[model samples]
Target: MEHDVPSLPEEIIVKILLRLPTKSLLKFRCVSKSWLFLISSYDFAKAHLKNSNDDRLMFGSKGFSMDLYTWSPQSAADHSAFGGTIYPPLDQNLLVQRVCIDCPLYEPHDVVWFEGSCNGLICLSSSDESLSLWNPTIGKAKKLPNSGTVLDFDYYGIGYGFGYDELIDDYKMVESLSFEPFAGAPTLDIQLKVYSLRANSWKTLLNWPGGHAFGGSGKFLNGAIYWSVHRLDGPIEWVIVSHDLSTYTFSVVHLPHLHNEDNDDVNVDVKVLRGCLEICCERNTHMDIW
Candidate 1:
């Protein structure tokens, strides 16, 4: 027979659950069907994440798989790495990704982990291998069913864009894959896909013209996600691609004129600072900020 305690009010129960550690709450999900559904809701996820007191540090695995891991660092007393730094006590949550080598298409350093964060949630993906969203604070995670398509590393490039749509209260991810499939074919074939967390599904988005978005440089600001794209459509150019979350539309944000013709290779990185978008350009020997 199941031993039952005195019934507690649902509000009281929720308040108590809020105080419990994420591991305990996750285990309690199996106690009842209603509790499982409640714990799985995105609204509750936001609440739990906001209520959490833990801070996280993410590191990449050295193994062949190149998976991701998040852990709370211990103090100087318990760890030697923090010997000189001062830190307040922090809650500990160690969430490690299981690894089995599959030889990723790109180098381990090329993986997209610190791509972006929205309301304490992070999107992680690598060269079409796998994509997932994780909440490090509460130790909850949801892996997308598919990561779309990937091409050979020698002829492929990918970029990830992650942000929230406040109008719909939804979190979204954009995956842009550019590749050259055949020897005589065009150098760039761009395939785009977007995932909506609230809908719990992935959908194909309209393709941008011939170009490749630089992986791991997505910047979110003013309700749009932006990436630095190297254009291959007609005249070669390097520009920023911004995807508006609310409309699912795409547009180009051209860089300011930096008069130079001899600079063969240019690098552009996008960032958001002080409530505005900032672009940095590197051409051969000099760097420009705009």
Candidate 2:
């Protein structure tokens, strides 16, 4: 008696394997060298990543530890309502059930919450000053090349998104870094450099119009990175500087001023409340929405 060999078409196997989460796929790669190569291929990873994005767009928040949550509009009565506090808390069991079963790349640390999310990716920087571009769904990550100098005066910014560009076929990451003297007083000699992920290199851009300082975290949205730019002298006005993710250009957007009583000791600040951007007035009685 003779036995028949069990076999399936390559396309069928690929279709089935794509359904597995990234972690399981990584382990299964050890089954064979061919499987490892197939799983690690850029094209295969990109396809799987696109499929994962289609699955769901999960957002996490930064706290003592990252809190991962999936937005389920279907669970609510009115999906069109923006401010309805209808989202359910995603418990550990549910996280295991959903993300673990389908997303093999769902490591606890990989779900990092940045100051903001943009274009299906999050901007992350390490305390050691290392930067990376990460897509959590498919576990695809690219470490950005560091700025050569650790000058105490250096400042860094990152932006990522898709934009209409006649020259490029895919989206890109635009990073900007500026350097100024720490002790010589703020001057016009500050230098700025911009990096393009597509080109995998950096180029010097025009200097900022005036002496400006950035503190806290940066937010990426609508093909630009927005951050608080502090002016040296003004009515305590905070400026929002936006760097075009595609063109690598910088522009300023005005922030709404807080209504305040004439008190010299009063202080105001800007912050993101829930998901909306808001300004906290000095009196602490009202929040002005811009």
Candidate 3:
């Protein structure tokens, strides 16, 4: 007597694997050597990643050191299984991708961590001007070469963003510079610099798109990095800026009109929700989200 094992064609297997969640795919790797080989292929990696877009959330904190974790939202019906508590970490294993293993900075305040996660890679930046690309899944990291422009803290403030360029199959980090002249530096300047992981170098950009100051870390969505910006020459108003990683172009997104009588307490934040840009505002007792 002979036992017959079901076998799937490689093409069919690839399609099936692409639709599965990362957790399930990781387990299926043990099914056979063929499965593992297909899963580890470059084409399979790209297809699987594209299919898994917006399936999970990757978030990190800045205080002290830095920590990154991945969370998956559950369905409404699944709430009953949790006994009313939707605590993900308690119910599932939260993949802590990075935990400041060997800190690059002596003083935590001296350097800041700005992060953007894409296709299993996390890009990190520092206030003191350090950049790196890391794949948390493989525990591999590559420090980006500096753009060679020194920032004189006395006159300039900088913000960083990261995203992937599908056209060239590369990843990029865009740095926005805001300059304020003091005693000798008479001309106010605003500049931009971008680093390419594929080329392993940085290039400076002139004609600063807009004089808007980037408030904080940006959110990556639709192959671009989106940040909440404030125009330098205008009032204390907020606007959303998007920089396409592939084309290296800039576009401005107007925020939703808000009827805020008390502007002092109004707070706005930009985030990526389910593959779309979301602007959230809160003031006093009411909140408006768009």
Candidate 4:
């Protein structure tokens, strides 16, 4: 008896493989040397990750390290719950990509892990001293420069986003820098900065009224980056600081009501949760809403 062998084009097979999750794709490497090469290619990796919008948020603590968790809206009782028992380790391959692309600035603990995430990027700070941005998926990072001459400032905010300019074809990183110069200062210095990946530098933008910090890791939506800012009158405000990736201009938008009754209860710690920007007021409770 004779058997017929099915035939498929290599391009088709590659596309099908790309659709698989990273774990499944990694397992297929043993199929052949050619297969391994294709899976490991930069283009292939990028395509795979870009398409896999898992929309899951992972959380980590200092002692517990990092654990992957999924937000289940269906489970209204527990919005944040562990999706699976097995937690994957941090992707070093992605980290290398971040370092190469300069997605987030990584200094000695300057990029200390923070809860905020934006456009697959995570917002990090340097041990209460500095600011940095990171794209976790690609492992790219860009560190923001210190704003004031004094390093003793108490609060800092950082945001990242991409936009288009009519004149240019590429996207740019819209970064906003907000800080309060210690407690005794009468006024807070509100400054916005734009970092052009193409130029590989920072440019100062217009100053805004009132004090604002980029809420959590900023959420990049509709070509704008959204962050929560605090007003002096004790009201938490939501502001959208938009950056035109192409032209590289900064603009601000006002959001709905955001406030905390207790002076000590402020929900300024923002992060990208489940692909949307969210803020958590109570650290132990981990309340996040996008």
Worst 10 residues of 4 by lDDT: 92-101
What is the per-residue lDDT of model 4 for residues 154-240, given as tens digits with 9 covering 90 to 100?
A: 875544444333254333455555567677655456666665545656676664444454444455554555555666545455565
The sequence of per-residue lDDT tens digits that candidate 2 reaches over residues 1-290 is: 99998988889988888888887898889988888999989788767765663333344454555554555434333343434543434451232122231223234455333433344554454444555666655556666687554545544333222222224534444343434455555432434554566676756667455435454344444555555655654545666666665666778766665445654332333444344544444454544445
In model 2, the runs with Cα more than 4 Å from the true position are: 32-34, 53-146, 150-190, 196-200, 207-211, 262-290
Q: What is the lDDT of residue 201 in candidate 2?
A: 70
For candidate 3, give the lDDT of residue 73. 53
RMSD of 1: 7.6
Candidate 4: list runs displaced more than 4 Å.
1-7, 26-37, 40-42, 60-111, 115-124, 128-176, 180-183, 196-199, 207-217, 230-240, 244-246, 255-290
lDDT (10s digit) by residue, model 3, range 88-126: 343353322334533332345555464676777777776
Candidate 1: where are CA atoms >4 Å away?
Answer: 1-112, 126-128, 150-154, 184-186, 207-216, 259-264
Candidate 1, residues 1-290, lDDT tens digits: the string is 99989898998888888878777888989999989988878777668766987654444554454555544444233554534432312233123323222333234556544456666676666544777777664555677777556456567777677889989988988877777777656566778888898898788876564355473457788789888877554654677888899998888866654447774566778877445787887778887778
Q: Give the TM-score of each candidate.
A: 0.61, 0.55, 0.74, 0.55
Question: How much does candidate 3 score in TM-score?
Answer: 0.74
Name the TM-score of candidate 4. 0.55
Displacement of residue 162 (Cα, Å) in model 4 is 8.9
Quick one: best TM-score, which candidate? 3
